[model samples]
Target: MSVVNPLVRAEALEARAYQLRIAEEAIKRNTLVVLPTALGKTVIAALVAAHFLYNYRDLKVLVMAPTRPLVLQHRDTFLRLLKLRPDDVQVLTGKYDPEYRLQAWQGKSRIYFATPQVVNNDHSLGMSLKDFSLLIFDECHRARKNYAYTRVAQAYISEAPYPMILGLTASPGADREKIEEISKALYIEHIEARTEEDEDVSPYVNPVAVEWKLVRLPESHRAVERTIRRMLDDRLQRLSAMGVIRKNPKYIFRSDLLEAGEALRVRLEQTPSPEERGPLFAALVLQSSALTLYHALELLESQGPQTLKLFLERIKSSGKAGHRAIVSELVFNGVYRVLESSDLEDHPKVEALEKLVLEQLSSNPSSRIIVFTQYRDTSAYLAARLSKLGVTVVRFVGQADRGQDLGLTQDQQSLLLDRFRSGDIKVLVATSIGEEGLDIPSVDLVVFYEPVPSEIRYIQRKGRTGRRSFGRVVILATEGTLDVNYLVASRRMAERMKKMVKELNSELHPIIRLGPAPEKKPIPADWIARAELPPSSPETAATTFEAELESVEKERRAKFNRELRETARRVLNSVLTAGKNGLPFEELCTELEEEGRNPVAIRSAVERLRAEGQLMKKEGRLFPAGVEAEIPGARRHVFEVLRVQLGEAILRVDDSFNAILLSADYNGPRELLRRGNRFSAISEIYENDKARHVRIYAVEELSD
Candidate 1:
């Protein structure tokens, strides 16, 4: 039987017992629902939302997801199941203007579907959370750290009068600390978790047959790997001899190197004496080069020779002292020559993937397949190679430009997904971006080109298929490499996750009820009363409502403008105070945020200052206008293009360094400004934690 509710469409949603039970528990407390994927977590969210909308007529509902697509998906699902009017539901994303978002928040939209970043930004810019009765955080595992989810949830809890949060995810992860962190961030008091093994869940679960295809590295690839290993060993020995790293070279992993680098950076920050800094600087460089070699080894072993070649070529072209050092050694060891002379164009996994895709298509001609790879390079390679073999395929990656590799825009991504759903595209070669809450229920097969170590990602990837019917999963792992190790680690972590969740469920105390359990109640008749209009005509009421909306919009716009102008003034003053040394954008943000300025306001302020010529960016540092500081010597760095405009592009080397590349300065293709593109460039200016106005003397687009 379907749920019987006036707000929910009749027979639109089947009343599952588990879903209802979970919803009942969720409505009573701030809850975390850790149900497995494809088990209708959204359905449970909808049920809870419907309950609140019925019971608390004056309150609003806020649903937040990590991505724009997920936000839209939730919006559609709610619209489909609820009897709410079209105008009563709204969607907000980064694409929407802040003024429109402000109006939407203040308008009559009781149900809002939004990306967390937008909601967080809006909240920062004076949007109140007090009226929201329920805030549902999708993919709640991301709530940890400084993620937007955590900030939004914290605000909602502190601001909402009778706040109730519903955190949803397929897997919260194996780490107890992380699970607790997510719970604390979301103010979760209870957990409603279900697995496929649960008696209540099994009936609705579709079995997925998983198989592992293990392949060995070719001897030629092994030869290249041996050379890279030797190069890595040389760096490791030097670091060990310098007493920077304690781990034996044989037992060291990438994580250890990262930790060492972080530790060294912290020590460097504390040590001011140049006499002691020389060796530390040298050790830091050696550590970085060692990490690079480790990555190259992984690419060669896990990804194919072509991917490795691309990486090596980028390193060779780089001007960083560490990169140059690594390249010189590679040249001395003849690794580049070996890569150039290799006959292998791709990894063995590519061949295995081709075979699996062909077999799946032959058996089920209308089948849709999702091939998951760890790298965009592999995604591009697989898509290209598969297309050559006459398979309909497309590469699905995140919206970030990396050199020549351009990412799909939201519209492009949505259109491609639509085509894939319509059977126009048979195979989707996707990277990590496709491992999350993408709704593709008709997918017949999921191919993991490489196994990820994260249990959360592993579950999400496997959950892609086996959604609506019995599905097949084929994981391709290279024998005796990180692939095999990662596969085992992920499985172990998944098991540990299930166990931890179970333990938490058993340990968590249920909310004590003074009265009987709350039942779904109908909306009170008095709550439906609108403002009395003295028997006005329908046309008159419509005109009156429009005028009221206009008045509210004008008020919101005025308030927003006042706040933006004030923030801009503060930003300009801050930059002017910094003078020639200038301020790092992030440091400036921290200072303003400490003064209670929201990120949106700060960002708007910065943009306004830049436009008014009150502030200038030099070497990633923000400086006041009219400062004629000499440009520093140019150095090579790989920068990721964050955003592109008509004549200039914003590039980021890391968190501390950012640059602006003007069209006049860049002689490369205009597509270089495509988001997520990475390229080698020489910058003539440098400042600590500051934005640089850079000239791109030489540009080389890194291959995917």
Candidate 2:
């Protein structure tokens, strides 16, 4: 094909022509390309973009990345690959002024890169996707339900004239269901996965070594062990009662784990004595068990090892105030030695990770490494201890608030990653966020802090290394946690992904020899004839049950409405009588019952009123917003109502009943309340209701 785009003529890309041809063919069939990390998934995207751009000169191309930073990166790459002028590509985000963005969209930019949320928001504001011909979804595995990616794709597919779509990802997700969901969301027809076993891709991809590490917990902390076991037993009982879990029973999962930790903390706060410190210290151990158990389950899911020894080691060290005494205490008097010396060393996951880490560390001392753990505290402790031993270690954490329980902001994440890329960081200690697409530069080793319950994570962690160079992955497993379950899931997912890829290839690949397209099986003649018959009595009866449900729901709604209206009337009257001073909870409850609201629904109505801003709560008291105002006509009874008609505005609410005020132009003083309502309006009130369309720049005068 003759090249029309200047960037497509690059000498460096000529070597990729065969891959480009394959991608182009795949695009014609709406394919998915599961290339490994750093395997130039974007290169294939650019090639496909180029082919479509060349043929459909008048149409626009859209590329979407999951994050804003990735969108900018894609736009930059496409700019280089398409040989297009700078003005021909643009990165669109909601951060920009909407008016300016709407103008930019109308301009010459043919390939627009954006985060899905930005596109969805702008589309809501009237940005049309009708002219776009080709849409590309980066990190396509995220195209599953309810994500902005799926909505944007659906919008484009529905609006664009000859819509073609392409999706890219380092790893899709955990399992067949996730993969299938992404496929169905994107309407993908073909999928390509290239593993070491794949003949065509084997030459370019390298295999990595994996090791499993298991550390035995020592025996000195028997009291701590007993406390943990008892707590777990109690919690499991509660879980069983709630029907949440049916476990054979493990050493963790008790409600008292938290209570014990809280009790110990209180004692430490009360008395800094050595006697109290013993039990306090033991409590911390059990607390660590609680945290460790939680993360262990996650690690097991993703990595497949239930017991995470390194995790326990690191956490136990957190309770340590001094050196060898810390290790000695655990080894000599603690339960750590007992667990470590237990027969669990033969545990499969423990054995596997131990082998992986020792083999890799012994052979490759200078290798850059990342150990993925589930708990932040555990990861930090491990990094700190490792660094003290002279291994360069850094904790890569998610952005979470001081007491919040989620990952960090994307910016903090970017900084940590930049440090890793520059080689200033030798080891990356991270959580699951590291598993997806946060690019960490080349590393010779990747250690699973623990096995994760997610197959996608297992694959992503393993895929991290052995990209451009040889690498190794080591999984650290503890003996007893849910680690075994995670490992089993990971293996199953890998097998499923491999089988899916094989099936997809067999169906789509050229050499797979397409016989005549398989014939659509005709409906059996008897079945076709049977379909003409009416529904049976049971089927007809079941259909009637659905209609009965609708009737019942309608009746429930009508009753609900009657109760709400009565409650609203009472709330409105109470506000008027209180005259902006509102009623406390006791008075409001009594008034609600007197006003005919069911005592049972009074509390609920009060909550609903406050939530909808129809009622305001202050100092444990409730005050109504008078009533839901109605639209007035030229001949309406209430002429004093201040009707804002022209521009958007918000009435500032504050602690006290302040003077009526406005920052906008007012033609007249109108009513604040209306006749036949709970509260009556004054004789004259501010009536500047004509200013509601455009946002007012400023309020001109305050009128009462």
Candidate 3:
């Protein structure tokens, strides 16, 4: 390790010839650098930034990562490596005020490290990229579609005078098209990619022993798998009957169900006639159910039995009838009720994982290991199961708040990582969040709970280890499950990604330089100020007029309010005067109609009365909020269509009816019903052979 010159610092960091060579070439062009992880990618970025600053003294540099932790990590690295004033390096995140960020960008910062989202937001608010000389995008494979990286890159290309983008990633992707898209999005031309096998990198690379531990499903677990398959088959057959499927249920996949559901929604939107829309909606319901059933079976078969149970519970509580029905069959009053006891032979992968983890601990006691699972439930289950093996375990998931164990806030994740780094935590059982850019400490072992089919994920997970020292990577797979395909696909894709990148570089020449550099201009004082919105549109003008009219109408409503209160009293009197319970909804609307009252006005007054606790609604009739009406079994027609759903025995009201009930049922559904579709006053219109006109409305249509 030696310093190049007095301008750059970090003499402890040995300047690798390969890194310097690539960084030197990449600095001149908008490039995408595909370096294997732990090969000093950040160092190359810092070197490029220092060179840019040295050559273009007036211009600043912006480096972007995907997460705040990574941003902080990169900023720290730059501060240590680049010889500059401490205040010149700034780390911007969402936590920073917009005004504060804009001021910092103006001059307070020379090298800015930030999350892509924050950069996009600030740019949107008038912060110009012209100030920046070099834009380094870390984990740039994510710069696709509407991602903030793509938006920010576009801004840099269009806004900057001499744009140079250095896109960095461990592996861009398996597919040539996607990698090409990333390059195009970032305006990338030259690609400097190096593998561990490359002559320049061979000396610096640490060997990682990757092992595949295969497990076979026991007969007892297969028994559960058989039952789950049968239940799934039944649902699929029902979906086929609904015309949502043309193929056999056995052949239906998640993608197939999703495609059919999407097609149904599109057809429903395009179909002009309401009658035609109904069938599409019904087909969508079946497609949605089939999708749910297929995934549930996948979880049951591949992701251990406990994950399947938790999934079912979550879906059942969600009030989606499709999942609830299958769950009910497995839980209560079904042939395969053995799942009630937890002692059945659990997933074989879980057992195999425990053995490998114990073996790793025995081989190296102080080693830190990360076990990556696809589901939070699986992670939690693995953590619990592994804890019994006398190994320290913790479930590390993302920031999304799902139940309790599923959520790990940013702060929580940081603390856990710190503990794992210092060897306070022996093992980390993590979800997809672990694959993303986070400043994770080098691990002794990286285990894939299940082989992921995606090349990006596969590469990222493997990159976790073999950085600082010799590391071990174990991929656990069920012999006959999707893991087999995923394991094979991952290898195939990793190989393809390299070939594709090499082919792309040979075909597309790097853009040497984009014209002459423009002079640095003074940033306006108002750049930090809030953006002013344009004048109001016609819709807003009409809304304002309507609001003013409503205000004046409220003044006129002084007289109407008195009449409505008096009318409400009369309705109460009628209720008391009439003996049995309260009037039926039909009779009530009829009585109000005879009195020459506006139906909407009458309903508004009734709602006002209900708010004041003067009346309540029961069985579609006004009663009292806390008090039950004297309505008997023969009293007001209660319908009880949705109540049967809660009871779990509603036969005709299957998933199709439940999907309708989702919009027109009760509580959440009842509110949706009240706010009916725009076309008609009918709360919900549905085809039903049991009702007249072969159609039914959630709330019976009010008589004219």
Candidate 4:
């Protein structure tokens, strides 16, 4: 085994021939590297970073991922591989003050790791990208529409003086249109795609034995499914009778319902009179109800009765009557009785999954495994059931908390993944979050709780195994439901994506040819004669030029600071005047900004003060040490509830109320969806603790 680097060797990661070839292509061109998971994608990223560093000592490289965990993962890989100085590499997340991040972007680290959102935000706030010579975008398939990836790519082209891009993903996309969109968005100059089937890759990849574990819905389960379907039909018929939905009620589907609701919402926005909205509002009620019932039917047929029950609980908690009629029908038709049963009879797939898991465990005593499911509720149920079966289990989910679904924080997720890697957790029941770029140790087996139609997700899920050794994968499918359809669609899409990228690679073109769109033709001579104004005097021209230059300078100063140290000094003096009670943290940052220091520079100054022991934090306030008046305990104040109004200014809601913090992302009415707020809008969400420590991992939201 040849050593790849002094820091990273074959034992850490075996650099294969295919990955080396891809890295060679990446360094010379702004290329998209598509390799299957467990194929050293990060190794290629590290290799590319090293090339940029060695070639251009003065330039920096920026590596971005979509989530904090993924960012940290990438940062760790680079740190382990390259022997860089401590300050040479930095990881930036939303937890840092905006000012500190901006400074990092301006120029501080030779190698930087950050989430795309943070990079996007700093760029928007006037941090220049000209200093970054290379940008490595992980999960490059997400670079379409208004996603942060697209915006960053646009800024990189316009702002960077010597820009080179390396877009990385396990799968670029599912279809040709999406792949082309990603290519255009990132201005992908070349595509080097590899899969497990490639000759070079096949030698390194383990043969994963994939099997379809099919099960038929029990009679009782089918009864419940039919009853729910009937109720859904009733709701759709109600909408149809009102002429709100044109589709036949009997054949209406979940996608159709979603499309109809969106259409009605658009129409409602254009209508002027309240009288025209009554029928529309009533139709929306039916639409939401029918959709809820349809989902419940799907859960009953595919997931199991327990998942359906948990889903029902969520619907009732939503407090929207859309699921109310369906719930009532469930009780009337005796479906609720079946739902209350703890038996696996209602969900045959659960029994089949249990048997498969047991068989794998019996065959191999020490095995790591992951079970992928569609819903958080299913994850919870599977974890409970599996634990009862004597399997150590945990539920892994995303950062977006929905209703009773308390999404895992980034730090919490990191810790859980660590435990799983350490064998403290035997099995992980995971939702869509687990399908992303976050790493888990190579598992002996991966079980799909249900088939998913989205090929991107399918590839991610299947790629989890066959990393370290020959792996086994079991997919559970209900005989006659969408599960079968999903399995086929995923296979078809994956094949198509691979074929399209390979074909497109042959006709690769440079990004320069794609950009700086044609300039407008010279104005017609006749039109110029009619519209042109008289030339200005030299004095007048200089005055106009000076005014324009002054405006530009003033704006530039607003976004950056050359006197960050001086501002920090002034901010400290202002807080000292507030005495022992001290100035709130926001007030301190505000004072620094008034002194012309941005968040990035102001934070650096504060850290210097903190390190020197001149600054003290007490009761959510900052003050100089050795002052009078009692130091307020940051923990002394606690509230059970809070009502926060929507506003442009940042609001830090701190209290002892743990429930409010957990349920902050909870939704109510149509207001939550429409009144969009940025992450900084609500700050400092804390969990209730006698420890009095603030929670940094919790992403704050206003659920109430």
Q: What digit string (tens of lDDT, one per residue) describes model 2 on residues 572-641?
A: 4555456455678778778667866555456555666565545566778765443332324211111222
- lDDT against the true structure, per candidate, is 0.80, 0.57, 0.70, 0.72
The list of candidate 3 runs beyond 4 A from truth reads 1-5, 234-251, 328-337, 439-442, 509-515, 518-704
Model 4 TM-score, all chains together: 0.72
Better of 1 and 2 by lDDT: 1
| Whole-structure CA lDDT of model 1 | 0.80
Question: After superposition, which runs of candidate 2 have C-alpha atoms over 4 Å from their true positions?
Answer: 1-6, 14-18, 94-100, 220-367, 386-393, 399-412, 504-704
Model 3 / residue 48 / CA error / Å: 1.2
Residue-by-residue lDDT tens digits, candidate 4, 77-123: 77556655444667788866676566656655578898899999988
Top-scoring candidate (TM-score): 1
Minimum summed lDDT over a 10-residue window in model 3 is located at 672-681
lDDT of 3 by residue, 1-704 (tens): 12233446645357799988888787667878998888888888888887776555578888999877677678766655655544455667886666446545654456788889999998887788987888999999998889999999888878776888888999989888899899889988889999889999999989999999887867767767777677668767877777677778778767777777787887877899988887776666656666776776677666877887787667767666555566677666442455557556688888788888888889989888999999988888889899998888888888787777547666678788878888989999989888865556668999898888888898888888888889889998887777788899998999999889998987775553446865534333253121111247745743554454356434434645675666666555444334235556568768887987655446556666666644556787754321343322212221223333331222122123431333222221222122222111112334455541111222221211
Backbone clashes in model 2 = 78
Worst 10 residues of 4 by lDDT: 691-700
Model 4 off-target regions past 4 Å?
Answer: 1-13, 236-251, 331-334, 341-346, 402-405, 506-508, 513-567, 571-704
Error of 2 at 111 (Å): 1.8
